[model samples]
Target: MSHTEQAMPRRAGQQGLWVLVAVAVSLALLAGCGDDGPTDLQPDAGTEPEVCGPSDVWCKDQTIDRLDLLTTVSTGEVREEGTTSGEFLTFVDSRAGGLSPTMSYSYLRFTPQGLTPVQIHDQESLGSTDWDLAVRRYTLRVNSGTSGPSCVSVANTPEGTTFASVTAVNAAMEFKTEAWFDTACTLIPDDSGLNGPLTQLGGFWAYTSCVQMTGRVFVIRLADGRHVKLEVTSYYEPSAQQVCNQTGSVPQPSGSGAIRIKWAFLP
Candidate 1:
């Protein structure tokens, strides 16, 4: 029989098998060579706490804690005024241990959470006392309604005045105008009598001459660009003991009045 016409029965089933294998290899190579580009990933949302904004309802509704700054000056001491620290918050007795009005001023470091003391420069190099060398970190303003000086009202409420900075507060004081809404902003008087809702350093006294820090909200700004809204909840100890004596003398050590404050970090 001629070779061209000869039957090759074993090769019939596997006919075109090489071509099929080549096509399968080509497909596999194409898949392997596909563009495996970088994926666009995103960060997880809501990982951080939402900061309270100025107009947020939470700002008005949040409970204000009573922070006490005690009479004694030291670091990490929890008094009625708030936490006491020579670095973050300091009540500088210009009288060198005397707590007289105008004779005493305070330097507070305005952080997001609370107040701190201004940094003290080296006294030996400058030849000035620490109190003299210390700078004013922030200013405090007294917010009373247009009716003026209601110590009994709830502080920083929707009905009450809002917070104001030191400059605006001083302007309000100078112009005798309102700091928030129609609420009048009173300049803290230098008198030791604790009269007229005057903005004294550390805390303010009520019309009754008691260190009741209700309805007193202060808008304070720091040099480092922090603004805070704070209220004096109490200027007395938990036992209803006053922080400062009406006679302008320091309270007895046992009965010493501490500064109690309720504050919020503002945007």
Candidate 2:
């Protein structure tokens, strides 16, 4: 979905919901190293709801017995997959990553009366959350008005005066617990380009990838007082000396260059 089209339905009282931004850059894709100028894969508009694949969206290892927590992947992967309405799809800043919750954990559901936008650092624990969804509980360090403690949260729950809506702001905190790995990504050259130096860089950069971005990451205060951050966030910085080896005497011992997303922006 487009950025501007994203809507908020949470009631106020809560301010500064942690929102991660994922911005990937592809010089090859933008440079037209292939046949098509842009990857013409028609992004399924909200028009025809398609099937929700498990990977499309789901609570990993979550028990379906609880009922409405989540539906089948084919049930609501995207807006089109589910019913005709747009409520089934909760599209956050995915330029972010996946946040899947397991079925064996205890979670709290809150319905607010008003929802407003505010930025905060630390707040009260809305409730004990389990990203892994195991028996372990993680403290929820909310973005309070003043960057408060590791736990606690503030909310604008249906006072009636303000236009309010409630949302599971911490769903990702309840799931998507994988830490960012600087070594899990790589780069590939544009071989489709018959030009001079274009073919030489093909796949030559995969082993030379040095960008590690844990975009939209946060130091969340868990139920136990421990702190955690989400993956594919801005805090992720890959080691520079971990990519391609042009020679036995490479200057930095590895590549330390961050990948460029033609239209990248700092979070």
Candidate 3:
């Protein structure tokens, strides 16, 4: 069955969704080290009715705001499979190095068909020869926006307006939760490319200090074209140095945190 067909009819008041963490024994997948690009397999863009009635599962009576999802710190183990209450697939970055308090990555795979999320070890492992298992993916660039708590944003695109790989979303204007949405089913895409938000010197995913991610917001585009706005509400783990004595020692698990998000399938 297709993704849209599998979407369950849910209301907006759902809260306190707990995400369970699973440790996979698979090897770590390094980034920017391989030739494999993002998977080209796009989910079937099933059509939605022009007018959604109150009982339609695909229709949103009201846009859900500030829904919280929890993730455990990255313990060097891959979050091979997990699902959020929002029905979004969440995963941890399975790189071998210890999770840097300042630098870390995770992913959200949007499969409307209720497909289980997969742990991606590296770029080359993104797509398989088997067509049915292939999934479209994006990199989660976790960082502090402007001068607030750590915010979650996408690294591939500079802004959420147009889909591109070279530019990143502006940290100043587009990095806050309020900037991504206006109301139910209404979204304003970030058209400002270099002019939108600016990241720290090393870029969006670059880590500076332990408390750098305290406040920020991130907007991500799912495979099915839905937009999710995210904010890092809290951190549940300690710094990498605090967890591991030496950089070489098996780094302590780190990336887990609390995320508050607002999502909708806008036209």
Candidate 4:
């Protein structure tokens, strides 16, 4: 749907109601004023209702399920064989180019077996269901919202929870879509690392002039309802000689956008 025409019934709240009430009161007063006044207070018979303002618009359409669009591909062999039952795979060079405004995002698809890189980039990714998550530097976007058409969303795990501890998806867990704007259509700041808004899955890391992983684990609920627990392992390249402190402050930072994540499909 067009951004302006999005079905945002939630925005038609007390303000809209009050507008109607005020109009009714004005019409009633006009009716009592004189019989000479022309009667049709409403719009002409064939005329459309007033259009809602930009702030009144919202998007609630159900996302396209990517499971139906899965193309057969060779899955990457499970790597790291970590402490948990889940697989740990690191995606190097998620930072496509330097932070140019025109730089394209690196896209990847998550499957039950492993992660695969998606070739298509730019606006075309929004229409394709082949990809689940798109990364550019530290910022991330799922297949939903202004990002794409699929219904991928995420639920953040509680504090101090290990990846192995989160085995099943909680029925009551709150899932968040890729929301970039406030109710007033303002862009929420990414603050720490980038110029964009902080997305649902992008909360994995925090900034303090230098970037650091928040150690937050998230349960990603794919478009088809399967859950995968994910943790961002590192933002710096493991091979780099200069290591930053626990606070993620380094004198000459290299490998700023190189990202590695640990994830496993939950039962």
| Best-performing candidate as measured by lDDT | 4
TM-score of each: 0.34, 0.15, 0.29, 0.64
What is candidate 3's lDDT per residue for 1-267, written digit by digit as tens? 666555532222222121111112122243442546453544334753222111211111221121111123223332323244533333333332333232222323334443233333222121211111211111132222221122323432233333212133344533221123343544333332322223221121213233223234345533322444443322323354333222322233544342222222223
Local distance difference test, candidate 2: 0.22
Between the candidate structures 1 and 4, which one is better when assessed by lDDT? 4
Report the poorest 10 consecutive residues by lDDT, candidate 2: 72-81
Better of 1 and 3 by TM-score: 1
RMSD of 4: 19.1
Each model's lDDT comes to 0.33, 0.22, 0.28, 0.64
Task: Give residue 149's lDDT in candidate 4 (0 to 100).
Answer: 70
lDDT tens digits, residue span 49-155, model 2: 32221121122112122111222111111111113221221111111112243221222221121111121101111111212111101112122111111122222
Rank by TM-score, highest first: 4, 1, 3, 2
Model 1 TM-score on a 0 to 1 scale: 0.34
Candidate order by lDDT, highest to lowest? 4, 1, 3, 2
lDDT of 1 by residue, 1-267 (tens): 766546554465466687788899999987986555333343334443333211211111111111111233323233223463311222322221224222112433344434444332211112111111121111133212221121111222222554333223232321121122212322333344643222222333433434444354555432222344555544445345333333333344432234445555555
Error of 3 at 228 (Å): 1.7
